[model samples]
Target: MTSHHNAPAEGGTEELSRSLTNRHIQLIAIGGAIGTGLFMGSGKTISVAGPSVILVYMIIGFMLYFVMRAMGELLLSRSGYRNFADFAGDILGPWAAFFTGWTYWFCWIVTGVADVIVIASVYIKFWLPTIPLWIPALVVIALLIVLNLPSVKGFGETEFWFAMIKIVAIVALIVIGLILIFTGFTHNYANGTATASFMNLFTTGGGFFGGEFMGFVMGFQIAVFAFVGIELVGTAAAETKNPEHNLPKAVNAIPIRILLFYVGSLVILMSVVPWQNFSKDESPFVMLFSLAGLGAAAHIVNLVVLTSALSSANSGIYSTSRMVYALATDGDAPRPFAKLTGRKVPRNALFLSGVFLLSSIVLMVFGLDKSTGFSIVTTISSLCFMFVWTIILISYLVYRKRRPMDHETSKFKMPGGLFMPYLVMAFFAFLLWAFTRDPDTLAGLIATPIWFALVGIGYLVLRRNPAHQAARAAHLAKVADEQANARAWQDQQLNASR
Candidate 1:
């Protein structure tokens, strides 16, 4: 059996420190679960899907819970695994690691770009009506880069406070909503009127399906976007302190959070204002606050949404840099990206990600309307994220089949095992189908394959390069030796204990 000393470093000698604690992990998970999608996109969903949007959120959360569990189990199966990409390579091949790592990097970069642009637009329109869009966009990019340049703990702390703001806001909404409901409050709008009552959900609008089956389908699409960052907790597993304990706590709490933050808020929003009164272009949170007689409701909601965008962009920068660092270490990307700073931060990889994030400025320069540009970018980002999710499930299936013994021994095994992965994949397939139903989403669907094709071609080209061939061979040897050593140690412990 190979010794741990024989196991080569997968990324490099410099490793990401386990600085994130249970508190940090918990808040990061919550922060990821809540994003601008819920703050800004929920209005469109309510307008489109009526009261039934609640079910869409719940269903998406349910499926993604299993996906997160799969990821948690995979990360725990091996200590050397940095992220899903590492395990994908170990179980699948070098190509799987390359594709998954780069695709995840691409996913967050696209998401970051979209987020900064949205933040800029929000600032210009709401507070500084005279500023150019590109100015604020550039400033936000710089701010996020500086914030992430320190350490993983800094990122964790920033996300913690950012997430706290959102949590408080949602909880406040729920509390106020319950108060209004109990006091028999009523709100009248131009399109429709509603009262603070449970019966308002079905009786006022088109009922559960939201007047048309197509609306429900469209709700599924938007709701999928809202949950885009839910798997971020898995990404943080390697950097987490005591991941075995913290990871499960974060994953288990998802259902309760989804019910309260998402489903509860929607139910109250519809009860107070009715689905018909919601506007596609406005935020339901703002509208609900206004209905409750808050004069500064729009401004307050804008600030919350603005912070939400910044938090998401911050997460994008962090995730993308780490992913690129993983790719470079594995010889899938340029060697320079594998370099780390004295603070243990992936500076080179972070710089590269920040460079891509600056594309948002170029997007702003194009002068596309805020709503139109946002829709296009988010659709593409959502598509890329779906691809990442599919890879995780595929990797999980491969793990279960090839490592049955590992599965049997795993303390944090996925609940449904094979059935859950397949079931989740089917749900993803349905979401993809739903995408094809809308023209905007269909455009995104058409554009997504082009990226995969490019990555595939790049992989083929890299395979022919002598340098990459050597690096891949060395990495695989290290992985094999490491696994052997791990097994040897496990057997030794078992024998000694007996």
Candidate 2:
């Protein structure tokens, strides 16, 4: 209900409220990283690797853990880190900052659009199961826009509840499944399709081609995608009350999360229902409950996914607005984006990002269903994030060469160090290969070049803006005046001494 349309015609940095607590940061990291994709998409990975899909999650989680470790090392190393983009610029170059800023902005925009589609579909699952997905998708988009248009605290609170719902759902499912595994609870499908009592989860289709080793390896890419948003914790640095203390706690919780959320729920799911029966199109969690004769589980799970979608969208808006703000402050984007309203929120930037978020509504007009529309936008999953990962890796490499002693002495150093980065980079490259293999995501990868090209052209175009030129001149002039004033003050003191 609060309007952001009153932003000043004058543009500059906005001092936003830093009310976010450690609880918010931890939950935001957990919730942002583990999205609907992990809950639903993991089902597909289950079929590929059977029980071994658990390894896929752990492996990718480990690799990313180190990546976050590297980021944390640099971020906490100096208080000067405003955001990751600034760090990239400081270590790499101004161009690195510009590209990272805008690419990250696009990444979140595309991601939020995908989440919007999922939220709409989740709504339709109830009243109008047969109704087109686009109608509900639009409604969900409108609702999140309303949420995001408010102050930062409003978004944080909404995400707090949203994440709590998902946590409860996963916990409940894990508890119920564990009981069945222990007490041998019988279900309708328990006798017919049940592959094995416990080991069926890892039966490995047969031998080499069986769903064990290679299958688990094959699922790594998707599993990695599921954890794509984990680093979102870093993005909240500007809003966090005390980023240093809170960030370490949030990052340290990743291993425990892997154990409980990813491994724990997954093991229970495999135990309750055989991995082979997993339906790629629908969430395996919903299927497990339906098979167990629980009518309410489908609706409950749907609500959880919808909540996840909202969280992802909220994060997307929050992150994209910041990235756009960074770009403008660095002169990579229009100065208008850096402008803020009285609330200290980037209102204009939020509006601009919201327009990109609404692009999903147009996807509906293309005669595509929400899933397909969602699919198109979701293609940025690997490309944009991988680019970020690449930049981070490159930045880390630069950090080591530039400051070897710092690398040797840092407490939060990545385990493998120089050797590990090469491995992580190789892993990232393989994931890209995995992305290329999928037809649904291929177009997004192809389109990445065009987007980068636009950024290149835009950077050059913005270089010539008259207002921008004037702003640059004014900044340089101010710097000169400060220098002249310092000289005159020193001379006046010398004259008094004489």
Candidate 3:
């Protein structure tokens, strides 16, 4: 294990600046975890799982909490580690880093492309019904690129406010829902009149699990998508101020966020409107607001969902660029991606990610229904994230065995130690089984291995190049020296503190 005192010095000349404050880190963490999945997809999930969707979220959240904890401890263990890939390389070997890094990059690219398409389509409906969808899609890609070009701080500020809107909306929903539930507000739906009450959740059509266990199993696919970006804070550790303090604070807040934002809001939505009343064709949020007699609720929710898409797209850009930059620095990607701008932003990397985001325009040109396109892309993204999470857990197990001394002495160690990683792995295996149950997710699961094969082929080709071999050797040497220095410094700090 490398000492935390040894900051990375090999690529010190072109590193991202630590301008993101504690507040920026907090909201960015929140922003990354919450996406269109909760706002838009929840309607379909509720329609399928009924009130049992609450249990689905809680179970997923409970398992992922350990994943986040494992990630937190890994990042804080070494100051030089930029993201999961860096630690994966150091602990697991170069191959782990290569695959994990590229896979994560691929995940965000697909997610970003899907998000911009959604954003553009929403804009066409709400503000520019007359315009072609491609125009707005191009404009959105351009706008986000400009927003990210300035610096890391600019990205942080944009995400902070974008996340605030989501937070405010959920809080408002929960508060208003409590009032409605207590007052026994009754709203007539197409099927029947639903009186707002706690019992409404279980009384509608059927009781918990909707009297069909398959419905509960089906919700697992979309529910997993809702928690896709929970590990994003681990990626931001290198660019955060006082990460040892801020990182844990952000991670510890995950349970509360899930409880309040996910479970709490779903309970409110179902209680206010019976689960059977939610339409798979529309957002449950819009339905709840409209049921409360808000005339423009559709438009309002449209705007909110639009911003949520943009926030997620923005995050995709930020995380992918950083990952690419890290890969380049390690000689695993094109050298240009490692070059930093005067403001210390990875401009080239950001531009490269933007180029892929333009592919969303191609989806529009094909005339696929926007909803269908989004569903396919999101399924692929969710499956890819599962791979990334699996790698993180695998790396954690290795870290414990290889660095027992560090694990015993570390301040931010994962609570469950050896047992937790295996438990989390088992849960992920169940998710894979759940994926096989649905044809859509099953297609994604089958298609995912082709991506790994492509990456493996690329790795083999890169390994044969003399220049690549030389670069890898030099990079490894530099990292080795840096780790040694870090360990020495950490020993001094320990002695002094004693």
Candidate 4:
């Protein structure tokens, strides 16, 4: 891969600086891959599909890896393209960019609100059970805002360590569970007793598919949430030091990360404790450690999961701010959001996101049950995230068709060529159908179109503004110039070859 950095700023004034290095980019990618959904939602998935949840996670990860590859190629296709929104606006027109930009902003905001709620009601309650929920909720959002406000480097560093804690926790669980399996450990459950052995995978409980086809199908509904933020590396493209090198390195490792972190961890967990014994309402991570007789297991796992939530909220705040900044600079959002602090941080956008996150406390004030509220928000988030993923694939398809020369010359090309995107899109369509089969997710599915309707309305209105029209025309003109120049260069090379 080529080493492409953002062009240096003329006056070194309000532009986003490329302060994130390879390590920062790598860890941030990891943080995005491993969300609270894996930590907190795994038990539900295990309960739903039994041993088949492993396959469910594998399928989701496998599909998403292609999506990420498509996004990586598009981001690197042109130095002028900052993120997907840039290409979406350039290729799909300004409306696509505006729609995607705002939708992505909303996706993270909803996710952040959910994370804030979980931290306050569930994680904090594990320790300070008597504390008012709103206090912790507000504090979590405030802390994440403060963490991101210092500088982009500070945001990267915070996510780096937060991701490290999650990695260490999962690795520890895998290592300790392996030791138990080798030693033939056994644990008692309400359903039945299970011995710690590889045979537990098939010999105990309902085996794979949880003994029902529908259960396996249901597994996909919950498992999809665990992979929500996998494309966050694409959003960080503009701020990365070397997009061509670091982007590929980070994207290529996704399969290994899924194997070790998601599939591997689930395999080890079930081996130690039979799948039937796992509670949908509780964490399998804590149960395994507690059964293994770690006196502090619950507390330790609680801390890890808490930090996982914090890391997600931190990402939401960081990404949402940048997305707004992108939208504003493109004339798709209010101009104030484009302003940067002396540290080059999007201060106005950051505060606006935090303010939206505060609505989590407002939701709590209505006496919503933690589980129900979190489920609704997360379901909507998963649906919206799928929309974003679908756009990335569509953008890739358009890129390949319209810019075949760029595709041919790309050092990092998407695997599966023209066919894979269509296949992935079909898979996503099936996933949407899968969501409709469940009542909770079905509610989210029905509600999601309303967001699009509003976005469409907003775009229609925004297009009337002369400033928005000028910005759109200028962006398209620039892309046309770049493509024309490329075609001319190709013609010159052909003539010289003769």
Candidate 5:
């Protein structure tokens, strides 16, 4: 571990504090599962896929559940592993770790940038139409960094309340929507009309799969962005209290959360407002409230969404900084990022990520429309996130191949064994093809490789550095020794039991 000299009175440790409790972990997981994408992007998805976007969310959630399970099993398999990147480096190679860590870091940074843009342009302007976009954007960035700078527990708590607001808003929407449906409400639009009832889900416009084949496919382009941070629990493993207990609890409940939060919310929203009535540029939740003549409540929903975007940006800052800190520990990033403050927070890494988030302000200055800017960043984010998710599955497959005994002895085995990873990867490949079907998404798809190319070039340069080589070699050797010891211990335990 790297030590900081001239440490402050409260600063000396080079380790992250495991201060996040079960409540924090559970809420963080909930917050991760529900994102700004669900609140803001769902409008676009409904406009595109009609009623079938419900299925799109279910499919994405189902596949990602397996990914979470795979991650949980891998993290618990070895005590030395910090996050997926650590195991990726150990099982795959140093280059895998370098790519996975940096890619995951970039994933959140891009997502954070989008969140910033949304906060500034869409949500903030919903109230203060006259306010400058950059002012609120910078304020949000500073607030998140300051809150996160105190401790891991602070971030967890901030996320907890943020997640709670989202939960309350969605629950309120669902309850209110159900009431509207039961009372037989009717909405008259300039183009057409819709009735608030469950039947609308099927009889809205084109039926359940209303948009036809291509429309259904196009749904994945935006819906995928909603699930980008689902694996956040995996990243916070090191800072979690009693991860073995909390991690599986969080991962295992994902299915129920999806059914309740994503599927349930959408089902009610569509039932209340009808799929065809949703606007691509507006939030369905806000529309639902507006339809009920609850203009104040609609404004409140918009505020909740503003906070939702802030929550996503906050999570991005927290996770990206930790990833940088992890990379630095492995010598994959700048050494300074490895430094921990008195609270064990990665101050330098946090500041760097916050600085990068300012790019969203620049995008605003360039006068890019909110819809265009959001689509570009989110599409790129979804693609990069897919790359990171693929790395996790690939790492899991290699871990199984190399350590069958560990799999046999594991407590939290992935339900599908060896077949699920391949299945999920195939689904992701289908999503990539789906991305290419839309022009906006296709532009993002085409541009995403530039990021990988840059990372690859950086990795090549770092590989030639003698210091990095030695550090990486030492890290790999250490991982090997730890794995060997773990295997021996397992064997001894089995023998003793016999």
Candidate 6:
């Protein structure tokens, strides 16, 4: 394959087809933002934060929008900002790139593992309800890897449908929820005031701040999950037909999606059934569907959850490969990952990433009995994604400072840039605190450093390799020599003119 680095000015990707359309982009945003997290765990979020989860969703949605806006501005400001890892390195530094790139790659690989576990555990019921979880987990890992190898658009198309399945399910659920909410169709056995009304959002979530400030703070847990892939739209910046136009359109659509899907759905759920009673044993969507007495509703919602996990893993792989591709191009990762197929897909990097994704299965094999291990992996994925998110915000800070003129002209400038960045930073730090406080999420926080330690060790080992060391030295020396020559040429030209 010809080097994308030197390819004609038009298209840059080699392995991926430009088969994605506006509908695809819209659904990608829709599919990504709403996932298993919202359908399955949102009930838990509402239970914890009460109706204030609405505010939680709103607040997190608002802040994450800035992150996307920052990503959009940086990408549009320069063609070089193809992916987040590349943008981090260009604006922040090589270390920033190395950290962001590898960490993000690890983020998905870890997340894919979690998805595998969920699939094997939940979907096994369809065929052999008695089968051990590990058996199905292995099958899923192999199946996903095979599917991913077909090429990016194939992956995109599959994900499009996977996402479509999820989107359709949620949209249907929302419609049904709205109907029950208006018609008082839900059983009101205990709660006398379960009739059609709007105050249910406030009343059902265990009366606002269920406990106190702590209860409100706990809401972030569920809020964070709902917003997990909120930045997913930005990951497709380079591949989209017209990024600047589509990216902002994608970003701006978040509010409506959050409103109808998250805020709207939650309103109906809590309104019908008090949020306090929901749990992992029961999903609010499933509960509502069953309440409607819909035939095979549990099975239907299970399929939705299954689709959600698969979509999450699918997005994870795409993002992981891109991170590897970006790092390879920048010389942070091995050059082979930089290889792209004629269709503009990073096949080599993708293949290499597939190899790493097996860690999830391996994790499932040994950790099946240990819920602790599962929790740790979950937290680590969250922490790693959080780290990646923070770097994006920081990269924007550096980008704006480094190029005020370019930013001024940027069509997608981040609003309230300086102040908002600080506020978001503080909010993130508070999230870190929340992680420490929550048992379910704490394992992940503890697990992340150990994961990073291995990455750091790998980086050091790679940096020490003789061939790579020489390449680094040569690249640095070439850059220095070029700078020196430019300085000398400037002086000579000035003297000659004088």
lDDT (Cα atoms) of all candidates against the true structure: 0.82, 0.72, 0.83, 0.86, 0.86, 0.72
Residues 86-135, candidate 1, lDDT per residue (tens digit)? 77777777788888888888888988888887788774469999898888
Candidate 1: residue 266 Cα off by (Å): 0.5
Q: What is the RMSD, in Å, between candidate 4 and the native fold over all Cα?
A: 3.0
Query: Could you give the candidate ranking by TM-score, starting with the highest?
Result: 4, 5, 1, 3, 6, 2
Error of 4 at 373 (Å): 2.9
Model 6 residue 9 lDDT score? 22
lDDT of 1 at 73: 88
Candidate 5's residue-wise lDDT over 1-498, tens digit each? Answer: 111111221233657889989998898899999988788789989889989999999999999999999999999988767788888887788888889999999999988888888788877887899999999999989998899999998999899999999999988888899889998888788667777888888986889989888888988887988888999999899899999899999999999999999999999998887787788878788788887778696679788988888888889999999889888777778778888898899899999999999988888899874666567777898998899889899999988876877888899999996799999999999998998887788888889999999999999999987757876677567667757876887798789999
- Return the TM-score for candidate 6, rounded to 2 decimals: 0.87
Each model's Cα RMSD: 3.6, 7.1, 4.0, 3.0, 3.3, 4.9
Clashing pairs in 4: none
* Candidate 5 deviation (Cα RMSD): 3.3
Off by over 4 Å in 6: 1-19, 186-193, 204-206, 369-371, 461-498
For every model shown, what is its TM-score relative to the native structure?
0.93, 0.86, 0.92, 0.95, 0.93, 0.87
Q: Residue by residue across 305-359, what tens digits does model 6's lDDT show?
A: 8888888887887878777876766556777777776767777777776677666
Model with the higher lDDT, candidate 2 or 3: 3
User: Worst lDDT window (10 residues) for model 2?
Assistant: 1-10
Which candidate, 1 or 2, has the higher TM-score?
1
- Candidate 3 structure, TM-score to reference: 0.92
Model 1: lowest-lDDT 10 consecutive positions = 1-10
Deviation (Å) of 362 in candidate 2:
0.7
- Output the better candidate (3/4) by lDDT: 4
